[model samples]
Target: MEVTPRLTWNEEKSLQKLLGNVSLRLLYKSSVHGNSFGTMLNKCSCQGSTILMVYLPNNVFGIFVLESYPEMSEHLKKPTTSFLLSFQKNKIMEMTAAFFNSTVDLIDNKLRFNFSQVQYVLLRSNTQNIFIPRLLGEKLGLTYDFKSQYTEYEVFRVEGMKDEPGYINRIAGATPHRDSLLAELRAYRPYADLVSEIRILLLGPVGSGKSSFFNSVKSIFRGHLTRQAIVGSDISTITEKYRIYSIKDEKDGKSLPFMLCDSMGLNEKDGVGLCVDDIPHILKGCMPDRYQFNQKPITPKHPTFITSPSLNHRIHCVAYVFDINSIDNLSFQMLAKVKQVQKEVLKCGVSQVALLTKVNNCNGVLQDNFLQMSESMIYKSQVRDVNMMLGIPKSNILVVENYASEREMDPLQDILILSALKQMTRAADDFLEDLPLETDAIAGMFQLCMRCQLPGSRHLAQTGIADSLFETLLPFMFCLLSLRASN
Candidate 1:
């Protein structure tokens, strides 16, 4: 018997986002089909790509079975793409096999779904031992002994899941261009003659995937998943120490020509995340590696502070990492803090870019094929908003999906990461090429003095030092310019 789907509009939208706009046809409902184990097996068996939803009094949770259920299988089958999804108070939490292994078993006259150490049995007559994992159970407020009699279970067959070509242009080639991108990055060198390696700093709000970006990049180069930097979704920042990470080539095991500097995340509340005042010191490259970040900003008096850091120690490019999902909900205080930090970064003349992470979480189509990021309207709109908010050029903003739950490397994902890295290298090169030579220092100082005589030089006039300094450096500036002209 056919049953009408009880899913709300928002719930349907969320499902489409996860499953790529597939149509759901209700196959069986326990309430209408007598809640018998044999009945569900008969109706749902051999249904390709089914979603089994268990509706409890206050919560709804389910398992998405990517493969068809066999009629009679004594042994369990491991499904690769299946996942567990739970909806609590309209918020969804999806967990894949990366979190825990999942298997489907139809034995002992019961249909069973096993997730790691926990099992869910779908039989009303028999006593169901629904032992949910403690971590997940606590999060969803579910007891270990959840009864099947108190819930309604429904199964829906997913359709129209055939692979479709991306509507938009692919951003980067998956396999063909992956090798070339790797080669280009391996052969890269700093444009600045003074610096051997370029230092790119990652900064963002808590849980913005700054550490995850570094981990993803390392995973690509290391040929496996690397978690050197700690990552979590806690309210406070997980990274306490400022770390400067270098990726090594897997073949030779030598450090790459660039370093990624990671620091504490920025929080809206005061005395929480990275201090806005400390940004200047960090940009100046005075902060030492592994320097502990407390609530207070670092000062010149700090014991480990480098009073005169060389160009090699300074940041060449700053990538402002932002989660695509949370960009719209950014707090005013956070934006103000970012703008405040950007002022200091501009003063240092470092290149800035915005990294829109977690693109998969925002669009289901992109989740399946990340190459279509430019084509996804949702993705494009988010990029536009980020560009507007940060005042960064649209070209400077890159989209990436970090490795969260996968065990192996994906070439599609690698392409995105490599493309972003390539842009960073280019941006760093621009900053390096534009850097003032030591011989031009006197000319730069002269330019600063000339600016002091402008109409809005009231502040310099108030200090009463601009005129005297200008008079003192006047002859030297001319001498430097004359020497340059003669050369």
Candidate 2:
């Protein structure tokens, strides 16, 4: 019989590094599954160094071998001849020859150990219990070739995405609703239409799909797929300048009421991304459009800075774009940066949303049925994870399949893009109504700054109770002053 590579390669309960160049087959497991030892023997035409793995309800595990057993039924009736090797951590802990069904005695009397209280290791595992070296494979009457390799393979029958016919059909049915979704979004007038357009600032780590998001939205309204913004696969920021992209209604050719402003991708390198101090300035419309970013911070004194800008020039909403597949790969420092940036967004009193891109690449069912994109388990998990990481609401986080390579317009793709746009506009409207609350936001930032100046908030909160000694000696200074005056 051939060794099952997948079963033997399991590392949960077995040390696979010890299985170097060994013929390992999972012969038998007590009650989990697979053939019995007796049944397996009948199927094997040739045999030598046959190993038996015995597992019981207790934590004890055993390995016994018959050097030369002509028939499988012979051992069932009289099981006393073969030697048993008990091992763990790739070391021979004990070796004993079985006398009968219930007992075993150590082969070496010098080393004494107790098997009397030991019971079976009833854990379920896929790892093999027997290992026969390749040199011994031929000597054991096994004629199978040990060396065979192939570079190309096929997985035509492999297990994969569950087929949900009902859900899939619903997605197909929703294909025609793209126009309606787009119409509803276009009807939405921004709460604070600054300069007749609601400006949304795009923010995310490099490769987090910030640029691609602008391109996807532009493509949707363009009535054909378009790549207005540069998108790349590299980890560095492809967007060098801060630019604003406006969309027009496809049917009426009227300018859309909203615009997406993209910035240099957020970078982890020191002094690479948008500066912390520049955030407040940008929200207030101090930075002008199409200005290339540099490490140095710009103030209102800069040549391109828009001084004393009105509400039309300011950002009304913020969208944090993240790649669904790359959330786990992001470093901790990047997460801290994201939180810091969110604090700035909260202080600006602007509504925020999260866009998770590359949904098709994450799940096959969604790739096959575009309408079933939201129903995918992977998409739902990514949404939940992004929510937990940045504290975005579950409903506000949108899953979108970007127009990366598709040359033509896809209704399903447009539907998702329009849905996200609608939410952004709605959130922007809510922000305009509460714009006066910006003072409270500023106060919160000041409070945080004060706390950070302290040695530590955690220590300060608990320090009062721990300072009884200082409180006890407080009268000594006043008594010393009184004595000096008398002198």
Candidate 3:
């Protein structure tokens, strides 16, 4: 297979001769042909087993192995848009390279890919071996190797996320103390008259675990696996309407002192996903719960809006959610959009934190075993990346794995999620102190940091983060969050 396609769908006879026994179906054609994925899905009727090939504009090509194509029903049969034939036991299907915003990262027998990173994800699907190239080729085995010699897939190979590997922590397998961390989160209380709960505004591109973050936190307090906030795929925002989700204390059955305010997903394009202008309204708590934002540009003339929002309605903290594995996949447009949104957040003097989700993408700890989160230096490096790219203090970025496809609670996962919650809540507290963002807040923040016994704390000196007292306060805040965890 050459970098550029040597054949097209019109040359089916030649293609079939080359593919041999592997059944081939076209899921996507090029722009000139005007054939789209939606059209392809509607017309796809082949049953049982087949491999779905993705033909991109360039020579970019990829395929997914699907086992069944029974009649489409309400149930989500597959999570991947592309499908392929069943090849193994636990892993019923094989997902090779994916197109769209994010590509599959296949490294050392580890598979990290989010269909959301791609432009779209199909019906829910299951797979055991998601590792690209390696697992994919392992499925095709000798058959693919023999036939691939003549197909465009001969050159198929999985690529890494960055151009040159960035700074990575070498430490492995050691993590913060879990039981203690959970205890701290439970013991944490908001100290204020007007603010009973820390209202954190969750923001991130689609499929970044914004809603999952809420569910993960609530599950800890509920003492069971809970899916209180609706979860969606990478293609759309999981939680559409503006809603508030609060954790319920198990003993009292009353709401916790913290709440997560979820909004529409952030899109790469302007006027898509959540409206940029609406952010100010959301930050102010003017956007009412369940208020659906339309595509048309919003104006003040519209009714059903909060006219006189008080500090009670305003967001105390901002938590930016993102998939660590797909950080490289962030589109240039999306990056700019986040920075612009952040500028607005900074102006509000609200404490902000970056939540890196789908942490399984970074290291084997959360990938195959969520318990290994502490020992994974890769997770630490990912946290560092979020700090540099988004201008969040190094300590402000927390890595977490959301509950997905699992029905039971994992202790370590709960600890990571709770640690993040603790940090954000404290950041909110720092903001509520009413210190100016410019000068005195920095000294106040320094004093706050001195109070928290943060481990390996030096985020500010390391990152040289300045200009925002909120950012300066993150290291110390994280110190408190991790204090008991390390103990």
Candidate 4:
């Protein structure tokens, strides 16, 4: 069998550089009710290199093949693979969003990882030159040719495309009820026993004391401090890498299982970091190739990239940390960044909350002035006339005074923890609601594709576009109804 071109050492290193430290672990579940696609790939064997397969049958299928150049494998540590096919602009956007949302889910669930994990991906298609590469290349302006002159092509099918076993699908293949889930999530009680995770992104410029605030929170958990601690410092020591904290609730002031993620403080150069600037690239690094696609867009057919099942749909809420006493008066600018993050969070149905750090030492006059500025911001940033944006109530923006005084810290800690838990509880409901909706969305999309009628629509129809559409979709719809009733 002929294989696709693999990236040279420099090329693979460049792609890996974009991924940062994140890695993924690929797990192929047993075949579900059917193995139509699984069977086909199983039979095809690569002549020179092992092809990494990311398959979510009835949902999406992606292929990752090693390039022909073995010279590239002699990188510093271990060599990496490059994606074979490219995607279009729109498809790239869709898949990139999927990767971000899904990675959050996986990380929240605490999955395993390896250094030589599946990095690059390919979307398997019947034809060599599909729409995947063209769309992706156009979006990033990368040079790509699906029919790469350096690589040879071969057709291989699994022995029994229909008889494959041991492929189990996720969640019984049902559509989730988004609107209903949203409504139910709104009613989530803060004290309800929820066994879910919360993703707290602390974003701010350097010198905002983001690290101090996080350490203060840790101190509270460690019992070294009884009050809600807020650290006021001039600079931060955090350089790179994400710091994770596990928080829990206990009767003796020991609630374990709390996770705090201290991301690298944002600066000018970080604006374009692959993780921050190219959201898709970071997510793709976290995702397995099995969930990717190789098909590119062509005449008469709309090419949309798909992704694998995500860990969760919604982020509980975002906490924006701002220095309240900055001599430069950075509140307004901080508000703008918060708004930007709020918009991104809304995409996955999450809410945003503003955190005012270093409030204890602020003079009375500055306090009043800061409050007024914040209120004005709330007015401008407010999503709707009724109250909040994306179904979040306006009362959710939390302003706590983080001071070093033990006397002042007790109440602040209580209030902050309560607010954080409340926000997280609501987010969990939103996350659950989000998953089913995503599945239903894919089903709905495929249904639209099935109804599409162009000159050669019949030929496209034979690609299992319709049957695969229904198999995954109908179940999703049924599950949504069942969930609604239960709610």
Candidate 5:
């Protein structure tokens, strides 16, 4: 006997939104085939692109697989482009091949899932929801163990609309390319001898994924999904303190040769978000990590300010994060604030790039394959708008999707993120290469002092020499330092 799909109209609509206008065809139902792992596998085998839904007392959850299930397997199969979905929470978490290989198993006439190294059986109970241990429940975002009987479980084969356009072919050997890109980034070194690590600052409006970008970059190296930074959606900025984040190699635990500095998001309203006046201090590297942002910007009088920041402390590059969905409709005040911040950045001679984030939210086609972002008309127009608005070259603008609700690492996502990071490092190198040498800076300082006609400047001008270069350099250096510090 065949049973109807249990998904409601709203649930089906939400799935289409994520998977891009796909229809679901029921393949198996627990009540019809019996609550046995073998029977369920037999019915679902060879059904490509399936959605497996499990019903609890008050919620529904499932996994969306992009490949067909084999008839039998002692080991788990790789399922790239797959994700876990919770209908009640309206959340979707991307699943990785490595996670799939280690956590799922079919044995003893039951489907088993491993969480925190503990195995729990599923699809074995006909009268009730499968008992989920506390740890497993927590992983599923459930506050308590679910004890209610399972209403039913169903497997559906996802079919795309005939009129829907096909995805751009996956880049050849994209997985291997991801590995190579990771290797390249891991071996990166700063271009300047005086600077051991380049610092890239993230600046953007509130809820633009500024903090989330740092978390995503860190997660790529960590080899798992991590939420070291607090992230949420709100009218106000979620990040209140300036944070300097460093990524560590997963194997040797050595810190990478770059830092990502996060600041409060820019708000259009006065006395909100990141203060525009703080930009100069941040670019010059005077602001300390974990310094709280206030209604007013930091000044030289701030106790936490660094008086003599070194070359390594200064920002090597600035990444302005913008939501792709909202880039077209940016408020006038917000654009003005961004331009004002850019001016401060320009004064310090720092390099800048624009990072367009939340690409998936803007275009449904990108949810399955972010690599196709370049082919998306919507994506291209948004990038163009960002380029025009920021005055950054089109090549310097990068698109990326941050890990928001994933428990595992996806190779495709890694490729996009690492590529963006690679561009940022290259930009930092350019900035370092362009820096004036110490002797040149000193010479320029002397010329400016002579032209200003300070005390003893007339004698120095007449003699074309100074009694002591060191003595003359001292006062000028002090003034320069003071000027730098004040900014």
Candidate 6:
């Protein structure tokens, strides 16, 4: 049997394309036989895994050996095999020299390749040892050394392996948390690669401008106003459920294949909306009742909503639309609903972005006339009540006016939607990348991080002191709604 000699590192420099991936480098490091090869295996990330070492003359070459056998233990232990297949010093020297030129130190204890860095190195092993030059010689009708130790070597080698998924993570932003929603929210780029679809919910009460705004969003994609109303009447009874809309076209004009769930409008008779109530239908991976804990049902009459903790891991973000036309001052009920939204988000690990709609209709979303009302809502309903009740951040609240004739709702929609989506995508990507693989305490730490950094929390910071105080105070008004529900 003839064994091919290893090529000198410089001899095959032209074959640089062969060592294109990080995995191959690792494989060469693990499977080669030699003391020098054994030393190189220490640089790999596959700690505690048995490694294969090959002996070449100049330096050690080895890759993590994945296969194992009790009978081959002694052979596996020794770098050099003394049998007929023993490596020639010259062949080994050439292989080791190539590796030294290709490998470099990456953070402490980690060795990276000049080409690509791989998480796991896989080696290609074959019993047939063939030399590139001799193979070329045979094709050219040139007689070459068939068995000479100096001239013949088997196996052309290269390092670095390409991991497509790993490449995706590198391009996407890296975050520290484990929850997929948070990860999507945090990543810099849209997760069109990892997740095939995104679920969204458009929420607000009757006359809150939810429909008009929904129509506006649809208009952006179709290049015309919504021809027909998307809202539908309930067949079951007088009670009107909120309508659901799938935001098929992203703000960038990319179309989604399907419409998202839009809730029916809240009946005008009830004088309250079920924005929180419909949350269960908009999200995924949560039991109707619980994520981890039994979720409290949100009655239309009550302004508080609770969800199982696990809901946080599933749903990505919620767009809370409020009417700019209604009550210049924040109403206790409105504050209550906001609090309920905040609480549900926190409980289920969802990110919230607030939208104050209908600015144009009221002479301005914020008219001089509603200043007092806005202040009252800020002080009486929102600040000390709602936010105080649930400890939601004021930054999450956004004030928008869809009715502004001077500035159409399109800009507002673009800003709000883009901001929210950007935040969500960035958050989710970050969480996924740095997320520890360990499922124990590490997962808990990830969950905690998601709560504080979500878009809702970030927005709360932007609401300013007056609005913050208003949100804090509004929860008390819920007492009436809660009491009314019980009655």
Task: By TM-score, rank the candidates, best first.
Answer: 5, 1, 2, 3, 4, 6
Q: Write the per-residue lDDT of candidate 1 for residues 356-417, one digit (tens) a residue.
A: 88876333324434434445456777788888887899878988889887544555567788
Task: Give each model's clash number.
Answer: 0, 2, 15, 50, 4, 109
lDDT of 2 by residue, 79-106 (tens): 2223333333322223331221322222
User: Of the candidates shown, which would achieve the greatest TM-score relative to the real structure?
Assistant: 5
lDDT tens per residue, model 5, 340-413 = 99999999999999998887633332333444444544588888888888889977898888988754455566
Model 1, global lDDT: 0.71
lDDT minimum window of 10 residues, candidate 5: 93-102
- Report the number of the highest-lDDT candidate: 5
lDDT per model vs. reference: 0.71, 0.56, 0.57, 0.34, 0.72, 0.35
Cα RMSDs, all models: 16.3, 24.8, 20.1, 27.0, 12.3, 24.0
Ranking by lDDT: 5, 1, 3, 2, 6, 4
Candidate 2 steric clashes: 2
Alpha-carbon TM-score of each model against the true structure: 0.57, 0.53, 0.51, 0.35, 0.61, 0.34
124 Cα displacement, candidate 5 (Å): 25
User: For candidate 2, which ten residues in a row score worst on lDDT?
Assistant: 150-159
Better of 1 and 5 by lDDT: 5
Candidate 6 lDDT over 1-487, as tens digits, reads 3333344453233122222212222223222333132244433323322333334333223332222211222322322111011113322111110111122222332222221233212221222121223332232233572321121122222344343342212211111111232223323332332223344444555555555555654554453345233332222121143333444444355544223334444333333445355455345322222211112334424322222222232345555555544544555665666566556656655555555554432211222222212442332343233244445355445444442222222222333433334443444443334333442223233233334353332222232112343342233234334557879
lDDT of 2: 0.56
Location of the lowest summed lDDT over 10 successive residues in candidate 4: 166-175
- Report model 5's TM-score to 2 decimal places: 0.61
- Please give the TM-score that candidate 3 achieves against the real structure: 0.51
